[model samples]
Target: MKQICAFLVIILLTSCEYFNVKKTSSEAILNEELETFNWNDVDEYPSFSSCDSVSSKQEKKQCFTDILTGHIFEYLQDEIIIVTQDINDTIDLKLQISNTGEITLLESDVDSLTVKEIPNINDLLVRSLDTLPKIFPAIKRGQQVTTEFKLPIIIGVD
Candidate 1:
């Protein structure tokens, strides 16, 4: 009878261990150790915490740094133009926009980049920002730090 009682006691004690819903420190440690660290996420894009609420100019500057660091522009392959037309009526044309605000009509791959455009379009630059003119004029904090941009376009000969 004593042997059966001791066996029942052992079973009860072992079964109680399964009822533990609380996460132990040791368990957390083990889980963290087992998880594989994602280096690419760190090396590639900026984290939400780091990139969030970029309201101030300083924050924008930091965001720009993170953007360039991540090389987010590397994969951006913007087509100059997209047209669906018959070969007999189709023609090839090329256009380019420079940060200098120049709406250049480029004929050759090698062209001068020093020539300045009208409004001096720079980073996040566009030829005619319909929204920008209505929203924010020239963003001047301390001094003018000119940034450059390039946009290419292709048009049909017809």
Candidate 2:
């Protein structure tokens, strides 16, 4: 009877040790997984309303960029602003697309001469941005996230 009792105690102790090791390993794995997650890298790029039907990732990205460019050009093409001279320049626009697909114009960099030539150019750009449909924000590990974009617009006098 004493031998049997000793055997049972040894079995119980070994089982307990195994359980403890298992629990520690599981926790370590969870921590490692959390640490490996990257907050800066996005799983998917932001999407435009026009890109929703696309199936592939590259196609979606291209569609979004193309549609946005078209919209910006379309709005700018309609503006009647005149420069002091026939000027051609490029405007660098900084834009942020929020996690909820909201668009914000962060900044616009235009040549001093361009600004002087066409005062309402900034307003025109802002209006064009406002007219754009809501964008689908970028995806990071299945969560929607805000993203920044830099768009360059070409102004041609012809």
For each candidate, the alpha-carbon lDDT, in order, equals: 0.34, 0.85
**Tens-digit per-residue lDDT, 6-78, candidate 2:** 9999999888866664346888998999899876567788987668788888888788888888899999888
RMSD of each: 15.5, 5.1
Give the CA lDDT, 0 to 100, for residue 67 in model 2: 83
lDDT of 1: 0.34
lDDT of 1 at 111: 17
Tens digit of lDDT per residue, candidate 1, span 56-147?
65565456444432332222123232224321211111333232323333332221221122112122122222121111111223322223
Question: Which pairs clash in the backbone of model 1?
Answer: 80-154, 99-149, 100-117
* Residue 91 lDDT, candidate 1, scale 0-100: 16
* Candidate 1, position 139, lDDT: 24
Query: What clash count goes with each model?
Result: 3, 0
The weakest ten consecutive residues by lDDT in model 1 span 130-139
TM-score of each: 0.21, 0.74
- Candidate 2 local lDDT, residue 58: 82
